[model samples]
Target chain A: MKKSNIKSKHIINHPLFLPLVCLLLVLIVNLIQTPSFFKITIQNGVLYGFIIDIINRSSGLIIMAVGMTLVVASSGGTDISVGAVSALAGAVCVAVLGTGESYRMPYIISLLLPLIAGMVCGAFNGFLVSYMRVQPMVATLILFTAGRGIAQLITGSFILYVKPVQFQYLGSFLPNVPIPTPCFVATFVILITWLTLKYTSLNMFIQSVGINPKASHLVGLNSKMITFFTYVFCSVCAAGAGLISVSRTASIDANNVGLNVELDAILAVAIGGNSLSGGKFSLFGSVIGAITIQALTTTLYAMHVSADQLPLYKAIVVIIIVALQSPEPKRWYYMIKSGISSGRSAREAN
Target chain B: MRIFKKTAAVILAIMMFMSLAGCGNNKAPVSNDSSDTGTDEKSKSIYVGFVQVGAESDWRMANTKSMQETFTEAKGYKFEMVDAQQKTDKQITAIRDFIQKDVDYIVLAPNTEAGWDTVLGEAKAAGIPVIIVDRMIQTNDNSLFTAWVGSNFKQEGYDAVTALENVLKSKGIPDTQEINIVTLQGTMGSSAQIGRTDGFAEKMAAHKNWKMLDKQSGDFTQEKGQEVMESFLKSYPDIDVVISENDNMSFGAVKAIKAAGKTCGPKGDITIVSFDAVHAAFEAMIAGDIDVDVECNPLHGPRVEKLIKALEAGESVDKIAYVDEDVFYAKDAASIIGKRAY
Candidate 1:
């Protein structure tokens, strides 16, 4: 009895277990409906199939979610300006790359410039929220409103098309390689983030600050610095996502690039079974959540659902998933299990 | 606390400076352009206030360029233009400012179709004849504006379907043969998406053999277009034609098709039909990557100019003026692409 209780507790407490189960259920549904859903074929030494597409597409969201998870865990408030900041970063990168006719800068410099721009933008948000003591939502709202406009200004309100083969490799598959470059980039980001959290006290400090800033401060922790650093980290992740997106399309439209992507990042965090109100967090859960969301989109498209009704279908599925993950359902589930077990024990006793 | 306050103050100062710098740049171009035409020409110039829906796309940029080129002091017009930056409230405010300036004529390209009745009524009351361009306004009053110059979005959709039908016939495919088509729609609920989707659906319904395999909104962006098309390819591997609502999405579709190891073009296994005969669309047609392009001409500047000229001469103008456009096929693309402005 003790062993079974420990095993059940381990299953329930596993950070990635719930999302993995949800992803599996989706895959199972797809498999039953379309047997070839899991089939992956190699085309030109690169993987080609529905599953590959989901991984490739979810890379940006996964990277964004990782940073977002940190921010949410530290501040207990979400940043809504990530999408706009991403556009700004992409525009800056493309501007530095310049048009084909006039190569203004080297490729590496062009790439670094955008990432730096993202850091500066992130730093600005951090200053507003941490230093000025402004509400995170309101502080980030300024960037949310002005970020795309700033991006548009950088590009002269025109789509900057990058023609170099080197830039294309960031978004697309490299020569003779089967997997997309973004998948590798995302893996690197996740691994680094996971390792850093594991080795350092940053995660604990962030969680402590989020749970109660005054108490953390009383405990001699630099709670303000911790929160500020999380915002900076989130912005860098968003910049990485921006780079991968622009590389994929080889063009940047300030208005459309990274539009409404912040919602996806936030949703991924929620679906990953992390609390939006702050406290304990899981990077792995968010990654799986991002993959699940992308898989859901892919599954709907494979079913030939009309474009007009796509959002409605997505909303319904998301509602069900969120409901299942909520505390109310979990309590009811445990209650039912306990009741059934007690009734069986009573029957045995009699 | 002191250090935090100092840092916040520095950042706020930088933000303020940047905003001021942006404003300075916008005003510099108008002043320089007007001054370049010589001060003598401004004496008899007809002052026209033009409120534009901001430069969001290449098509919009081209449209704005055409207007700036035509409405110059040298051409007997003093143009004062405001970029609304895709905000309805901004456009209304600009219009109100123009009315206060008492310009000879007010030209507006509304960002949306609603909430213009009150401001437009003000312009009408001030005796400033407003020339609505590009998009239509939702006003119950018929005399709210002088005239509207734009394309019929529904007709553009019908024309796209008609062009596709002609292409199918030329390929020796009988009307009775079953044809599977997928569509990459624009932003949902927007006027373009609604009209284009509805018009095409109406036309496609008349044909018994034309079956719509799937339809998905790309939100009129290349990235979303490519992503949606990638999924479409996996589901409907045997699709014969792709109806992209705009050229941008069509470009994305081409990339997805190639990545999927499928051929897409006029001569390839799949035929691609796209709307908006922008320069890139023509180039795509010439390259045989696009089979047909329905022209939703962005060059409404010249047409609006003509109507304004007629109104200033004390002559009556039509309530609505439809700009003439042509459909392009691969064979004719090469010849027509050079002369195409947008």
Candidate 2:
């Protein structure tokens, strides 16, 4: 016990400890299920491996999770519209720039425009919920349902194929490396967000407002402004994710772009130990959590579960994870143990 | 000078009144003839009450428009068009209203295959002939509807599988090869999903090696289809084929495959097959992004109009009118690519 406590103290203080532990656990599971899971190889100068693919895919979720964690922590509310917003932003870019030709624009403006679009969507959502006093879930849900439809409508509900060289560069790998630029961008955003929260009063205000919005307002804090700004931040993050997403596909289908991804982000945030009631947030933990989910899915696929049963398996796993991570962990464990012991006793009596 | 002014003013007033009276008479004759000739234009006067499933998709919108246009053009019948908005209760109410209106025939495109026996029984007791259009209603009592005018959904599924198998045969891909098929099913429990899945399974059973790895319902929405396909791709990394019940779902799968840096064809990427040869699907075939597509014709409006006219003429018609459609492979897609509306 003493030795474990000392190890915990050492590990808990380290910023990278949780992520390292998560990676180790995931690797161990993958190794048991598929022996070649850890075997990395260069295929045509691109890194190809189970782990690499998982990481590559988990980047989008991690970015969404970072923003979601902050919004949830700030008590503004959950944004179920990130996925839709991402789709909208991607559709906007493709619908505007896709002519099977190049679009002339300053590089910086091209990068910044999508982020602005996302902010505008977020502000619209914020206005409805904060100013109009609509339910956060209902207000955000309006976009969640209609955003993709509008995006599809704008693109004429068809797939827009663009072979533009500049747009493709966003998804390009680092020079002589297998790491995707989106992965790098996601990492950079995560670090910047974590550092800003760690070093400024913004984090404190978010937490305080989340804990008690009325109290925070009574203390002269601008709750509505904070709520509105947090949503804008969330939307901007989603927009960046969309930009990278389009780059990865090199094409855009508003119907298929960023569907149901908000759930993943929320799940990542929840799994990372953030409170659903809006309090202290965990940026680093959310990234690990997103990676964990991607790894779990990869493991399931490697096991060759049938396609029809995938939904059943997914539901079971999500239920189990949520049950395990329920706030009353002790109660859950006790209930399970009691059920097991009772069943055994009854069988023995029989 | 005063006499000239009076005469000019009287002439102007008479001209204005005559013009107004002529316009009013023109409307009177058109409106009267519209009612009289409207009933006489066909043959026997038959009233039709149509309970629509709502305009949820482009196909549905087209379906509704087709029926409405056809009915409006038909001279002898007064057809009531009801939009159920995909609601069962609304449809039931519509059916009851039709029964109350004592229409000669009732037409319905049921949202689901079940929950219609009671309403249909009432419709039967009322002796109001019912025509099932585009979709099927669930009931063992065939007496509920006078006839059904739609394509065979199960046959459509079978046709899609057949086309896919033909493509595979031409490619010389061995049947024994493990073909991991990810399916984007339509709305659960809907006739389309059941018929498509059953038909596909029946066809694939002959080839023991071809097995479905994963299947999920996208609720007939392109967005849900993509979401399901994204997770399916992540979970089943080695998916070999994708079969969508409809073109929209297949489109979503195509997006996911492309996003993962994979191809979407028998020769290059994920082998794909789908129903509903919407223009998008046809284009995908041309682009070599899709393998096969079976047609589920959305142009049932003209056929419905014909049936309505026949019923109004008091002429006995075939209880079930089957529409024929051709499946398109990439090889033949170029010829018919110009014909798709959706």
Candidate 3:
């Protein structure tokens, strides 16, 4: 349907339309509430304000959602272990770096090990889902529960600090740079993913496997392999996110590092109108959706929404965005449009 | 095949009966031994079985350490601890295990506020005095436990107000100065959040000139705390003071404040008051990032020790007791940073 040459007149009702509108609506609400919400000022050569925060804070989620989109598309199932994997990855990063106010190992090893740890975790899930024929949810549930426990074992049930100026650069800001470092990390990951999809046959293979695994296998596509690759890649992406978070805080707290982040990543995928059942996906939509989620959170803090009532207000906005994306509202819009057109023709004939 | 199945069932029944008899025999010897030792106080060690919620963070580790160090062979106490690993079912099982062993006392740091009545009742029936620690379990019967010893979150909050006053006096701000304050709270509806917020609010009511600009929950994580602080900075530009519920949040707030080209601490633009005087908070204070820290003490071991001694002497102790806490200024941080147990 997306490839079809449908008339441009229906662009208003396109799949991507409501999500962009939802994002705009949230930002617009922010603008109306606080006129200075969009204002950006330079502090110590870095851009400072709520807008910078929205971009910086959502970078981790955006990276995870991109990986999740492919994972969901390949296996036709969601990976709920991304959050826990990130926590374990963070623990590995800090454990290698040591809790002392210095790096215990070379900086490069600390970075690579977490990604490798994440790959192993993802491979475990991939093996279960693709080879053992287990459901993705059940496969990932093993890591979802045990990952934090493993992390705690590494950190000795403590929030160990890495406290060095250079360590904070990736998560916060680089020396004399105007933008947050996470923005670059996230973009680098997204760009690599986009290039892989565009230049390689991975995009087609994953989508084919997701749409129909047996048919894709019969058609000479390594469907199971594609599914496994997606899980591994997704876990690697989660590890990247873990690195970003660890750098941002310069510390590792297994219990709190990626707490409830899987729900956010899945929610971002849903908000982007990506089917959790798999087949088609939009990375851009998920990115925008992540930004929108961050925007809503910032808006609540800016509005000083009562602490207990914060979730209630956030739920209301989310429900409206989701309702707009649903079929019934668009069905009503098209029904009213055709009714008006017929009435106009009948009046002209009279 | 039917005859084989019957034989298997008979074997299983015998195994089950043997396990039940083994449990009965274990209980008998434990009770008899405890009774035998009660008459010879000088020769026997007082056994204390602690059912602890797992070490989820640095604070919990310190808490477990405090208890382990305080109750030892030198102190004539035999301490046995079961880490619940943040699960209530495990805690209940550990408590029951302690009961079967007939320990003189059972110390429980509950994971949740509910679902401990039956286990506590079992301990009560076994005549073991249960000392509740850290978080309180909700039970209607006050007689279920001997005494509850934990941190007074409200006192920490009240003490923060007093600490802030000292900070203000030193900064030369007048008592009647129109001070603007904001709070980065912990998770909403949590005991810490509710107690600290209420404690601070109750005391703030006495100061007419101090204005609370906003209060938001940061969920007690540095990342969320930073994001919320950024938002708070954007909304209220001329904020004077910040009350972060925990040290992690305070660090995040300090980062946000610094990124916004603002300063904090004793000589900075904003005076930051934080709770949970962790070692990191001491480091932060010494660095002039945080002005003062009010301790939510995790050293319940000494308090529990005192209670045990009182109960041993047949003296009635308070139904609820609060562990001692301290308020440390940045000036004190330099001298006291080395002594922090956590």
Candidate 4:
């Protein structure tokens, strides 16, 4: 009993504890609402079911959350421009591919160009926030508003459609393969990010810089460069998510491409137990947080929540989850548990 | 005697305008080009200042295109277009600009129903006839604008019900069979969403065997549509039909259905009834992804031109003009796709 108690306490103290609990609570609600929530089936060699849907749909958000976690850690401000930048990236790819009779560039060129464009955009944001000493929010807001407009210009204010079946493989499934391609891409990103941080001291450097940039600079870390790199990395991740979106639809509508997704990404970071103010962070926690949001959305849809009431319900659930992550609720929870446990121990002693 | 003379003059003008329309496709061909140079050389084209709502979607773009195409240098319209980018302030400013320029006509595609009363009242005070298109304007005085012309969103919903009924009948589904349906709506509270949802629900009440399962807003975007549909599929396995409020959402819904290894279309497990018979929708129909598309026709330029001709001819026109619409099916999409102007 004592060992189990310690293990439970250890689990609660873990950084990912509340995030995972929130995710599990959301999943459990679905299970209670619909018994088949956990059921997965194979059809045409492809995975099909509610749980699979959550994972599949969350792939882009997960990728975005990973990058957002880094940016929030280093910059102490969220990149509200990720969604619009993603839209711009999608617009670039679709534009280069040509929605009309213009010659289609090689698909590889279409893919790489957007990354370069995202790099340029990120460089601009990073320059403003890190080098120019502008507030991160104000620095990023420039691109946030103009990115979609630039995208609209590229697409000529049209919803450009790329009709090649190969173009769609990234957003959907691979030929004769069951799993989604986005899952692979997101995993590739996470793996690279994890390996890079693990093999090198970049993770430590980032944390130190975020914790105290001036102090880290004194310790020989280039705080400005680290922050700038983090922003660039975040934008690239956003571009990758954009590719998934355009692929899924096989088209790009600048207005709605990444619509309000930046909010979700930021929410994921916060839900992952990462402070908006720069500090130490957990990459894995943000991934779980992204998935948790997708689960909540799926659960709401399954529960038949009215369309008008959906946003209100989502806000309510988000408040509860965020409040639970704070110390006050946990303190009360621990107090009640400890009170019961102490009474039981006193009786035993007597 | 004066009233009779005025009525006679109006009738004569209408006849003359109708005769001109019959001779050629273009309506109100301002002062015959060669003949006009001798008389009124200063006013060559009928100046029309259009305050557009922005190129936000394909439908809005097509609507803008229709206006641009109809009002051209060749067609005798000195058209000046200002894209408001969905901002009410910009639209109001554009109208004020038109008022300042003393243009022959002012066309507005308002961003919101509210907040237009003052600007429109100003336009009214200036005696510059304002034609509202695409979306309606709300004001205490209906005479704030000359005419309000756009799709009757509610009718699009009723048309979807009719199309669904026809699709079900063609698939040999009986009237007595219990049919479960769900709706993937557009942006909530917009004219499109409320009109389509309420209209479909009102019509759904007539069918005893039809059951409305759930209605969710997909925000008229492809990504959200797919997400909502995936959840609906998991929740209710027996959903016989999906009424997507727009073509974009239908595209997403079809993609989601196929991704889940389920089929949707005329011969598939789920029959999709979508709005906005865009060129893409026609293509989807031909590709066998969508069953029927209730067209929210965006070719309002000619309709507005007709209204303008009537107003120019001093004939009283209806305050609310609903442009005609049609329902396109997968069977006809192959031929119809090429003919789509958008």
Give the chain B TM-score for each candidate.
0.85, 0.72, 0.88, 0.85
lDDT tens digits by residue: candidate 2, A1-350: 76996796676555445444555665686678778766666644556566676787778888888888887887646999999999888877776675555765545665677677687777777666655667778878977876776666556656666655557667646556666576788889988997888898888888888888889889988877777668778888898888877766666767667777898888887767667778677677788878877776666565555445656876776566555555476476568877997998899999
**CAPRI grade of model 4:** acceptable
The sequence of per-residue lDDT tens digits that candidate 3 reaches over residues B191-214 is 899989999999989999999999
What candidate 2 gets wrong by more than 4 Å, as runs, is A1-4, A9-27, A98-114, A127-135, A138-142, A145-177, A214-221, A242-259, A326-350, B1-49, B65-104, B112-127, B138-142, B172-191, B207-271, B302-322
- Between prediction 3 and prediction 4, which has the larger TM-score? 3
TM-score of chain A of each: 0.97, 0.86, 0.96, 0.97
Interface RMSD of each: 2.0, 15.9, 10.2, 16.3
Which rank order by TM-score, best down to worst?
A: 3, 1, 4, 2
Cα DockQ of the candidate 2 complex: 0.07
**Model 1: runs farther than 4 Å from truth?**
A101-104, B1-20, B27-47, B69-79, B97-104, B169-177, B309-317
Q: How do all models score by TM-score?
A: 0.91, 0.75, 0.92, 0.90
Model 4 per-residue lDDT at B50: 88
lDDT of 4 by residue, B142-193 (tens): 8888898899989988999999999999999999999999899999988899
Interface RMSD of 4: 16.3
lDDT, candidate 3, A172-225, per-residue tens = 888888999999988998899999899998888888899999999999987877
**Per-residue alpha-carbon lDDT of candidate 4 for residues A96-198, written as tens digits (9 for 90 to 100):** 8986544389889889999877876777777678877789899889778878767876777788888777888999888988898899998999999999999
Q: Stretches of candidate 3 above 4 Å error?
A: A1-10, B1-43
The superposed Cα distance between candidate 1 and the true structure at residue A197, in angstroms, equals 1.4
Per-prediction DockQ comes to 0.56, 0.07, 0.35, 0.28
Query: What is the lDDT, from 0 to 100, of the residue B282 in candidate 1?
Result: 81
